[model samples]
Target: MDARPLLPSNEPDVASSPLAVRGLTVSYGEKPALFSVDATFPPAAMSAIVGPNGAGKSTLLKAALGIVPRLSGTVTVFGEPLARARSRIAYVPQRASVDWDFPARVMDVVLMGLYGELGFLGRVKAQHRARATDALDRVGMADFADRQIGQLSGGQQQRVFLARALVQDAALTLLDEPFAGVDAATERAIVAVLKTLKADEKAVVAVHHDLSTVPDTFDHVLLVNVRRMAEGPVATAFTAEALQATYGGRLAVAQLDRVAPR
Candidate 1:
């Protein structure tokens, strides 16, 4: 698979990045998970956050969205604080983090994405339903709208979560380990959806565990290990030295091919 380099033309202006993290630090109890991390995710491209387990990839995503408390620094979405632009951001948490057995229908789950715009307890109008339906259709899950979320397969469940983000019509999206438990077909489908998002100039930042797919799936890469090691176009920044530095020797030589400059 050819690595898709971050095109210079797609790069967003520094003064107005889609997502920017500056000196960000996150801690759990007294232990720090992320340390002074800084990175900018540009619009019109997919940015993959890659590192070994416990490297704070997921923490970075959560902290950026204010889901987890940040011990220091700040996150800006579309050049503004999260609070000022909350409605323009969408998030898809790790599939495992969600309780699939909660007994909600697929459509019901996707509708939750509108809560930001509609207010948490606002009534779901017909227009909202139509948007959710359109989102489901984009991910090829429209027919599963009536099925219980818990009954869907892992791939189907992932699609539903993506649909939730899509329906939000956000300018920036954060996804945590979306491809973790999905099949090849599902991965392909998700990649297609991501490309579409990029085409629409939406910024996508995802916690990606599969190193083999990163180069082929995303244009930018942020390598971290409790701190940001490297970030930029995958071709120029995803070097062997950087991978070794970020993964701390856990990354195998075989996985190197996926990130080799095209």
Candidate 2:
């Protein structure tokens, strides 16, 4: 694994982190969702965002992408604001967030990824379609290209979303719960795709809940519970202490031992 250093709070080094959040605060009306959260995610590695439910794991990703409003702080992608770096980023939101009843076909959905570079009115051209087809093939969903998105299974739908992200060819990919509702086979396939992304030196950050697989699935982790409890290489940052802090004794000791093992 090509381990990268986490950036210090005072230093705003662009090259060190693919995604950087500093003093980030978010709220839903008066109630705070996240507070003073800070962390750096690097390239050439897969990082998992782990915490209890409602830990603002999804909010952190959204704020970084500007999909959600931030109460304060900044999110930098490859050293610049999100507007300037939009084309270089790809995001897969949680599966449950989508309207499965939408009338779009699989091909139509995957083609959406190109909208950043193609603009709203730009023609999608034959080559772009071919690229989308190739991406679908990579995710094992090529046969479903013409099928309605609502007709597919949960795992299949997840693959189509991944295919969309793959077609973007982005340097940084943020995924919220890729494994949610996915079968073992789909999970393995997704991990394989993530490995390919890391091999290409892309940064892949995912919100993951399955603690047992974290050690094998990612090289780094961001343990958060409203505020970031820990962030770094999995071996060092994913400790019993961090887990206890982030989970607040809700986690079983056996699980912690398996995850951190002293």
Cα lDDT of model 1 by residue, 183-247, tens digit: 99999999899889999988899999887777778889888888888788887777877787777
The RMSD of every model to the true structure, in order and in angstroms, is 4.3, 4.0
TM-score of each: 0.92, 0.94
Per-residue lDDT of model 2, residues 137-182, tens digit only: 9999999999999999999999999999999999999999999999
lDDT against the true structure, per candidate, is: 0.86, 0.89
Lowest lDDT block of 10, candidate 2: 1-10
For candidate 2, give the lDDT of residue 23.
Answer: 91
Worst 10 residues of 1 by lDDT: 1-10
Please report the candidate that would top TM-score against the real structure.
2
**Where is model 1 more than 4 Å wrong at Cα?**
1-13
